[model samples]
Target: MTTLTQLEWRTMADDHRYLIRDMALGDTTISETVLHPDQSTKGHAHPWPEVYLCNAGEGTLYLDHDGGHPLVAGARYVIPGGVHHRVSTVKGVTFTCVFEGPRR
Candidate 1:
């Protein structure tokens, strides 16, 4: 079995305070993000829907129409396809996004 430390991380192009990594699970892609304190995503959208699951820490999820929502460990949020969203961390957050096909 592969450990968490064994996963490969890549620099996120959207921001400097975040790191990302992707793993293929069957036909789906799981993208994990590591966000440092006071950091946030660049806000974007894709053609495929996604599920955001937080593993640790806490943050706020800003949606295109729904405004902002609290994000915490063990919580999950569904993001519809073509809808824009971004995440900001007060401390730090480690989360995984599950989506179909490949990363866009």
Candidate 2:
């Protein structure tokens, strides 16, 4: 068992612009991501579906070609496998992303 307090947060890279804490359980991976204002993630796709649970602040979830969906605290969004998607924040945001497969 693991707790948030036990997880160590780390930045991916200078260009990524976000902090993350990842935990692996069996075949699933749970990651906590924190994005500051004006920060965004690069659009990408996964081999399996991804689930995001908003924990704080506000943001937008951008889908391929389509526009974007508002992201608010306490809301959840699911992105299907192979679908391009990304996230951006205006007032900063923290969310938990759960992957259906092993941690990559």
Candidate 3:
């Protein structure tokens, strides 16, 4: 893998959603992803475990195994490997995410 000279990058989509950069090397990745109300990642599972910190906003975090629940500010969610999960933003959401495990 090549080294990243810049630690972070930022961009905004045409739809006005913010695209926070993810920076990492080797088997770990970290990023702050902001999603608007009703936004969501299509349900899926990754090879690694992922931790999500809800820094702001409200929503419903859904894990296929853990069931759906209200996501309040300051809450943190952890998902183990092989667990199907996805998050839906109610009134929008911002999360600091960390991922660790064997790289896919």
Every candidate's CA RMSD: 2.8, 2.4, 4.5
1-104: candidate 3 lDDT, tens digit per residue: 45556555434232544445576655677767777776775568876788888888987778875668777788988888888887787588887778873224
lDDT by residue (tens digit), candidate 2, 36-83? 889998778877899989999999998785789888999898899888
Clashing pairs in 1: none
Clashing pairs in 3: none
Number of the candidate with higher lDDT, 1 or 3: 1
User: Each model's C-alpha lDDT?
Assistant: 0.84, 0.81, 0.71
Model 2 alpha-carbon drift over 4 Å, by segment: 1-16
The alpha-carbon lDDT assigned to residue 55 of candidate 3 equals 88
Q: What is the lDDT of candidate 1?
A: 0.84
Candidate 2 weakest ten by summed lDDT: 7-16
lDDT of 1 by residue, 71-97 (tens): 899989999998899999979999999
